[model samples]
Target: LHGKKINNHTANEAINHGFALVTEERRSTGIYAYLVIGFNSLISNIRNYKNKVGLLDNSRMKSDTQWVIDSMRVKTPGHRTQIGSLSGGNQQKVIIGRWLLTQPEILMPGSYTPLRA
Candidate 1:
């Protein structure tokens, strides 16, 4: 952060420093790809894509994904399903789980209002 605005240019840095965002646009390309790939590969990519660091091995990846699924109560057949196929709430849960994996310092969720009964 350091007083700089969080835009595309600063987003990566913010993420590295544990900043995350969840927007109403949950069906974005990245989220869709993440759903297709499943959590293990997603965590692997998150670790290696930007910094070429391997934070979690296969065992750890599975463990972490399970944790997320359990915590979010995401009722699905493991992490193999296309997240897009899930209901919107489940999809949001997956996205939230993904951001939570980042261990962010600040989490900004946008335009998420619960339905009124």
Candidate 2:
């Protein structure tokens, strides 16, 4: 389904154990919110925050999220700009960065993989 669109999203599927699957399509959905929310999710899950942070800290989240986006070279007008505002390549980078923040030993196989095997 590369370069195509699906009317429905199945990203909510369940997985056994602690595993992460980043699909190309999932790469573009809610691209704007993905960075903001995904950043908070990843940080909260991996750090000592442990849900103790208050909701008002979302500004902090947005700021930090923007920093990650900029560091990853995800071109946009600014950090506050919505994901839908970015080009296809930039949006893809955002999703990639979200996954990379996990620091998993990734195995992206086949032709879609960025690096040749």
Best by lDDT: 1
- Tens-place lDDT per residue, model 2, 1-117, is 245443423422211122344555644442444444334234423342234653345555565566567666766666556566566556556555555555444323212335212
lDDT of 1 at 86: 73
lDDT against the true structure, per candidate, is 0.65, 0.47
Candidate 1 residue-wise lDDT at 44: 19
* Residue pairs clashing, model 1: none
Candidate 2 error regions (>4 Å) = 1-18, 26-56, 107-117
> Model 1, 1-117: lDDT tens per residue?
668666546867778877878777876633664354265225412564333364446665676677777777776787777776777777777677777888777888877746222
Q: Model 2, 92: alpha-carbon shift in Å?
A: 0.5
Worst 10 residues of 2 by lDDT: 11-20
